[model samples]
Target chain A: LAKTTQPISMDSYEGQEVNITCSHNNIATNDYITWYQQFPSQGPRFIIQGYKTKVTNEVASLFIPADRKSSTLSLPRVSLSDTAVYYCLVDYNQGGKLIFGQGTELSVKP
Target chain B: EPEVTQTPSHQVTQMGQEVILRCVPISNHLYFYWYRQILGQKVEFLVSFYNNEISEKSEIFDDQFSVERPDGSNFTLKIRSTKLEDSAMYFCASSDEGSRNDEQFFGPGTRLTVL
Candidate 1:
């Protein structure tokens, strides 16, 4: 499993774009970068996933550089409800075990 | 969109007592998992069940913890003897299959408190 490192917390204003970056220097070739959003007292929800380059979905966008050592989750036009803990997970297919790091707590303030 | 559902949103039990957490995964899904998150901590995997058997499990799942698909629709996690440290929120998730890109849908969770 690739260990991921991210900020403990971040603050952003409503309508502002938020980008949370995760570093996985030991990412394997078969590993895929995935992001999950978790609100207080709720299970983590899948937001976006990508193997390389950019992949956009209705909720968020994932950008992975060529090296695949790092990836960024971009949330456009954030709202107060968007305040949640965001986790960047690597290798979701390895025995279906997702090792979670200390996630980035995004506080979207009004 | 279909969602996974768990019963007894909250459970309170005494130490050394037994407790069972129940979940009903999406009708068409085939993979089931159990995860727990202690207060002020990250989510940790407990076990994964597929085809009515366990495919994988983490160290957190010990002899005291067991999972079973007792029926066609119900998936259960039984703790033989509860401990104070076992208090946490247990989440149930299910995926369509074992494919790489399959997204796992999660239930709200069952908060277990052992006194």
Candidate 2:
């Protein structure tokens, strides 16, 4: 599994755009960038995933540069409920020995 | 929508006692995983089970830990002897495919407290 680095915390207001970036300098060709959201007392929820370029879903958008060494998770029109920890994981498409670093605690203030 | 389910929302146990955490993965999921989070810490993966066998495990999964699929619908994690350090939230997750490219659904988690 490739290691990842991300901010420990970020703050944003409701209706604003929140973008949390992750740096994985040692990413492999088969490694896919995946993001998960975890609220207090709940398990991590899958938000969006992408290998490269741009991928958008109802919850977030993932942007990957041509290098694939870095990716950003962009949340559009944030709400108070979006307050949670966001984790960025880099793993092989075949999946094994997945590791999670301390996620970015996102606080959406009113 | 299918979801993973775990029993005993919270469990309090004495040191040296055994504890079993049960989980019901999404009905169609073929890959099952167990993870734990210490208070204010990162989510750590313990083990991954596929086809009734363990496909991978972390160093955190010591000899005292074991996993079993007792029935077709249930996956379980057994801690032979609980320790004070074992206090954490245990989460059960599952994915329809055994690949990391697939999305894994997680349960609410079982809070285990060892005193």
Candidate 3:
């Protein structure tokens, strides 16, 4: 597992795009970057994951540089319901502990 | 899409009492995990189980905490003696194919209150 660094909080308005970046300079070759979203009183849900380059889903998009030192999650057209904590995790799989750090709390204003 | 499920949604127990938390991972998932979040704290991993045995565990999973896959579908975490510190929201998660690239689905979680 590689430790990740991200902002503590972010603010966005409805219909605006929000991008949260995570820094993991020490990410390993086998490590994969994953993003999860957690709402109040609810368990975390997977948002997007990537090994490198870019991957897009209906919910969000993930972009990783060629160096793989960092990654960003892009949420298009944010809504008030998007207010939640977002976690970025680097995992090697292989059964390592899935520890979560203090996530970035994104608050969407109306 | 299948999702993980936990039993008793909420359980309140007294100090030194034993409590068992149950989970049912997705049918096709090969790896199961347990994580707990103390109020106002980050989520912490407790243990991960695969092939009916524990593959890895965190230091927080001390002698007092135990996990079992007693049946095909039921996975459980037992606290030998509950303490005030045991009060937290425990979540069960599962992943298919058992790899870092695999997506892990989480259950709603069980809020345990230890008095």
Model 2 segments beyond 4 Å from truth? none
Calculate DockQ per candidate and list them.
0.65, 0.67, 0.67
Residue-level lDDT of model 1, residues A22-106, one tens digit each, is 9999887888888999999999999999999999999899999999999999999999999999999885656776778879999
Better of 2 and 3 by TM-score: 2
Please list the C-alpha lDDT of all candidates, in the order they appear. Answer: 0.92, 0.92, 0.91
Supply candidate 2's per-residue lDDT for B10. Answer: 99
Q: Which parts of model 3 are misplaced by more than 4 Å? A: A93-96
Tens digits of per-residue lDDT for model 3 on B1-115?
7889999899999999999999999998879999999998899989888888888888999999999998889899999999999999999999885566777789999999998
TM-score of each: 0.97, 0.97, 0.96
Q: What's the residue-level lDDT of A1 in candidate 1?
A: 45
Question: Each model's fnat?
Answer: 0.54, 0.74, 0.68
Candidate 2 C-alpha lDDT tens digits along A22-95: 99999988889999999999999999999999999888999999999999999999999999999999955346
